[model samples]
Target: MFYKYETHLHTSEVSLCGHSTGAEMVRAYKRAGYTGIFVTDHFFNGNCTISRKLDWEKQVELLVRGYEKAKAEGKRLGMDVFFGWEYTHNPYGADYLTYNLDKEFLLAYPQLCRLSFKEYSKLVRKNGGLLVHAHPYRTAFYIHYPPNPKVHLVDGVEVNNAGAGSSCNNNHMAWKLARKNPRLIRISGSDIHSTEGAGLAGVAFRYRIKSSRHFVDALRAGDAYLIIDGKITDQEGNPVKEVV
Candidate 1:
């Protein structure tokens, strides 16, 4: 069987929008046949319930609680748990899923919330991290317009968001962008906020990913496929209709 891994998820310990705790989320994924997951709880400016009144360092400390808890549980279950954040770019509701950076990087760079898309791209690249624009084309009633930053600057675009299937998500546009730019990685995820969202989307790696760093490298090298609604397809190449 392929090694499945969830690329995006949140937890009640950190994200205000999340309904389940980190441990609950991990257990749900484990039951769904996933070998690992990235605990991408909301960042400082995202749908975070944490108090921003606290100092930047303190804020990071609070933000990492969910990831740490999830990681610990993943260890106990023999799952590969990794840390990441879903940064909410203010003004526009565009979200970016980041990987390969640890809790310390976030604590060190609290100003991350203030950076423009261009600036954030540079910072992530400098730190050897990958930034995948989550549901880049997703439009919401609250968000006046769809936020599409310079696609070339981002490492990838989430072309399939299972959680967004319930809404009027425009993932087709992201798929077109990926086809036009062969170098741009086309990723997918559940964008899960609750236990029910688990396993709706994930990646199916040809080999078991050893760590978070390896996961990043695999996507960069186009070494995996996307799993959407229980159907699998090679996202590194031409696009196909995701099973609804």
Candidate 2:
């Protein structure tokens, strides 16, 4: 069994995202023959509102609505939709993609509150969600802000990011880390912020992932493939090498 999925797509409604609508994402993913996608928009404590002020509850509400709308559209188009959020950790910042969580959980703990990486990892684990570090090697303003350790505290790392303008050396870094810590999972995604970049990056898992929970479990169990396009394969799965 096999499944093709893109987990880090963005829509225009997101503050920093370009003009890509959820309908456009559905069309693109269907055209690319992808089985599923997770729309993980930016969720920052500082810029949670339209006015760029901290309204954490409103931000979660917006994201929940976005997910519902996208899921409805994807269902109509014969594609699976996964609800997710890209949380921006503050003070020694990092980005984490979390799924299968409720609005209450997000509203309750919108910010990490000076917790160390290890502590934060424990919190995520206790909540039955997965943490994936987003785009660790890009050199833009916010790209290089997150620090990378020889040992990561979370479940996985996103090796490929489509919105990244340069060659992704992050995949190599993630691969080396996964090699060292065999428990770590390496996943790749487009991180698409615009229509043009949607479906441009992804990961193919060898198992038949029927839902969001299955997809997350595949990554947590290290039974997935990372697609960096003409780079290399460090896991098992047939590659669909065309850029979507």
Worst 10 residues of 1 by lDDT: 235-244
Query: How many times do residue backbones clash in model 1?
Result: 0
Residue clash pairs of candidate 2: none
lDDT of 1 by residue, 103-194 (tens): 77887887888898789889987998898888877767645544545687788888888866722447777777777877778777898889
What C-alpha lDDT values do all the predictions have? 0.82, 0.66
Candidate 1 runs further than 4 Å off: 166-169, 236-244
Model 2 residue 140 lDDT score: 53
User: How many angstroms is residue 241 displaced in model 2 relative to the true structure, after the best TM-score fit?
Assistant: 9.3
lDDT (Cα, tens digit) per residue for candidate 2, span 1-244 = 4467788877766535536677778778888767788878776532333443547676667766656767788989988888777776664346777766666777787665456667767787688878777765555555446445524567766766666532557656655665677666667778776667555567766655676678777776766766554232446323554333
The estimated TM-scores of all candidates read 0.92, 0.81
Name the Cα RMSD for model 2. 3.8
